[model samples]
Target: MSRFIPLSVPNLKGKELEYVTKVVETEWVSTGGGYINEFEKNIAGYLKIEKGVACQSGTAGLHLALKLSGVKYGDEVIVPTLTFIAAVNPVRYLGAEPVFMDCDDTLNMDLDKLEEFCRKECTLTNDGLINNKTGKAIRTLVIVHIFGNMANMERLIDIAEEYKLKVVEDSTEALGTYSTEGRYKGKFAGTIGDFGVYSFNGNKIITTGGGGMLVAKDKNLIDKAKYLSTQAKDDELYYIHDEVGFNYRMTNLQAALGVAQLEQLEGFIKIKMENYNLYKEEIDKIEGISILDFNKNTRANHWFYSLLIDEEKYGLSRDELLNKLNENKIQTRPIWGLIHEQKPYRNNQAHKIEKANYYIDRILNIPCSTSLAKEEAKYVCDILRELER
Candidate 1:
């Protein structure tokens, strides 16, 4: 059997072992250690944000952001229906409901639909943005940069400002993505919002086994996040508690791995872009299938390469292609199901969900591991072409 080519996996070619070994040797494997601080500092520097608070997972970071943003029980948050359900689950964790929005061609949140929903369906008063249907205050907007492609942040920010909504960016898949043109030019994805969350999951562009980070423009928010993540201890000596908190701090061992992984992030992203381009070049020659392009206005991380399949033009269906590729020792996957269609979100309110449903069926994610060689990428494209024929 041929070696199985994964859809996406971590590339640990840097000092991962050295840093992890040091943590074990020093017996500092818990949350407190030098590596934790170093990892937080380095990631904040990379994004040029004020500060970063290391957390257990991206979901935890999102929960912290939602809590800090004061998303109460009766509030509603705007979220994309095409993203991973994790993005919407955090809103539920805070006893709030998610108002599902549609996706544009880029598979990010549709700014036009978002604006239309706010302008036509919602009424903005001095109290806050209120949904006419549910009669709930829309307190926040959680924007996920899907597949490392940035959403229309420039217009999204303006809409959020006009409607008085706090913006929490779910940048788990868009660590290296940044704007190259417009008013917020040169700003990273997460930093442009009120609070940004990053993931270092095993399949992410970078990995720390299972960890994440939180960042904000204000240093105070970052500090408060750190304090809240560490169990909200007001007095450590007496173990005095102020309010509710969580044990969501990233462990020292995880931070040790994160520091090393972050060191190679730029290089990994470069390889990802190159590999995506190679796939695009070969697949473009075939009829009925094409690789989607990132927003030209942004320096996208190019984390995941999605193949848009036209079943009528192409001989095989998307599912057939996915099955054939897996049978041949290549891993591929379809996009996530629409969030509003999920069981938990079935009762939730969805606004103008047209494009998201359209793309969900036609999109197939191909092999995009950073360690994928040029020949391997070509091989995947060649197989795809053959399948198309």
Candidate 2:
């Protein structure tokens, strides 16, 4: 009970050490190596996508995806305010602005509000969807699959096609998630969009220490992204650079870790699902707090479990509960603050940000790591129950 239980952490009990040791033994420690290629292929094959481009981090992958989507200066991209700020920062990196959208009960972008914003707040032009307020072209939609829950892609894709918007799926937290029904049946969260991005951060569902992968429906786009990620080398022999590029390529060490981690992804997801169900069963019986459920039509990775606390019913505010848990050595965390309210994005457009604000204050992420023991989960629940008035 004295040990600090973390909210989320990497599970590396696979071939990570063996693969990375091979990389080190071969002296292929930098970006150029077999590990990177294998990691890319493994991720692409896992998601059943055409191709993937490995990059330094999820932020880098997002930047590359936005650039490949033809998002330009003076353009606008739709994003969710309920997600990590990294998802929204890429829009600005491309010299475009982000139009923050609200979240639904599932904490994904509100499809209804997105449709409403596109229909009532913008005008369809020969070029594309144009914002009436700023007269800027609304070029792309960045959809973050928050906490591995698949967004309503079936409806979102319809909205994108009707409005001529390129869709970028931020599948950073949804590597193992897939749709089990509808037109995109069996499609992974990242594959159905114009571009899909995944993260391998230290605390993600998988870890490469730090890296990311960019995938797209078009193989040519993947090729271009790989080119850009490695400094746009038109001719590597001459070190010729025809276009501006970035040093976003992932290291051989990271890719080695990623390749091994990806091999155990299905198993890790199994553990995550089991732990999530265990928490749900126990927390459901506790008044004023319950575990949020993923979409029924999809097999989610169950990356992170959200604990919804009703202040009045729970007898404590989210922060109060968070503090008590931390004091008891349980590492619980509140959801990210609404991005629209952040200082840097304060002036950006946020349409009907109602539900996001409501959830932001009530939702706390509890310990759900793949390494979390069953007794540890029970201990967390017992602490919550004890703290409940």
Give model 1's TM-score versus the native structure: 0.99
Candidate lDDT values, in order: 0.92, 0.94
**Model 1: per-residue Cα lDDT over 237-296, one tens digit each:** 999998888999999999999999998989998999899888888888999999999999
Q: Which candidate is the best by lDDT?
A: 2
Q: Model 2 reaches what TM-score against the true structure?
A: 0.99
lDDT of 2 at 32: 88
Worst 10 residues of 1 by lDDT: 1-10
Candidate 2: give the clashing pairs.
Answer: none
Local error of candidate 1 at 174, Å?
Answer: 0.4
For candidate 2, give the lDDT of residue 74. Answer: 81
Note each model's CA RMSD in angstroms: 0.9, 0.8
Give the per-residue lDDT of model 2 (tens digit) for 1-389: 98889988888898999999999999999998999999898888888766799999999999999999999998999999999999999899988999999999999999999999999999999999999999999989999999999999999999999999999999999999999999999999999999999999999989999999999988899999999999999999999999999999999999999988988899999999999998999998999999999999999999999999999998999999999999999998899988999999999999999999899899999998999999999999999999889
